[model samples]
Target: MAKRELTPEEKARNGRNIALALGLIAFVVIVFITTIVRLGGNVVQRTF
Candidate 1:
């Protein structure tokens, strides 16, 4: 089968999707880091 080229709208939608995914990933990373920092070293000292 031959590969088909993407139309302008498809390319734009793909770009937007990529940007949204990157933004979401960045947000999660930021939240994770903030949580870790707020928790500090005491997290390791907790007993079960």
Candidate 2:
């Protein structure tokens, strides 16, 4: 049996998809860290 091959256009599209996925993951991590910091700030409020 022979395996199917990917053309140059298909390869480029796959690479672009992977890059977009990584960018989205990075964005989510940044948002998560910012949310944690904001939440912690509220929890550690000072009483003056």
Reference-based lDDT, each prediction: 0.97, 0.92
> RMSD in angstroms, candidate 2?
3.7
TM-score of each: 0.87, 0.74
Question: Cα RMSDs of all predictions?
Answer: 1.2, 3.7
Clashing pairs in 1: none
Ten-residue segment with the worst summed lDDT in candidate 1? 39-48
In model 2, where do residues sit more than 4 Å from their true spots? 44-48
lDDT of 2 by residue, 1-48 (tens): 898899999999999999999999999999999999878877668566
Model 2 weakest lDDT span, ten residues long:
39-48
Candidate 1 lDDT tens digits, 1-48: 998999999999999999999999999999999999999987998888
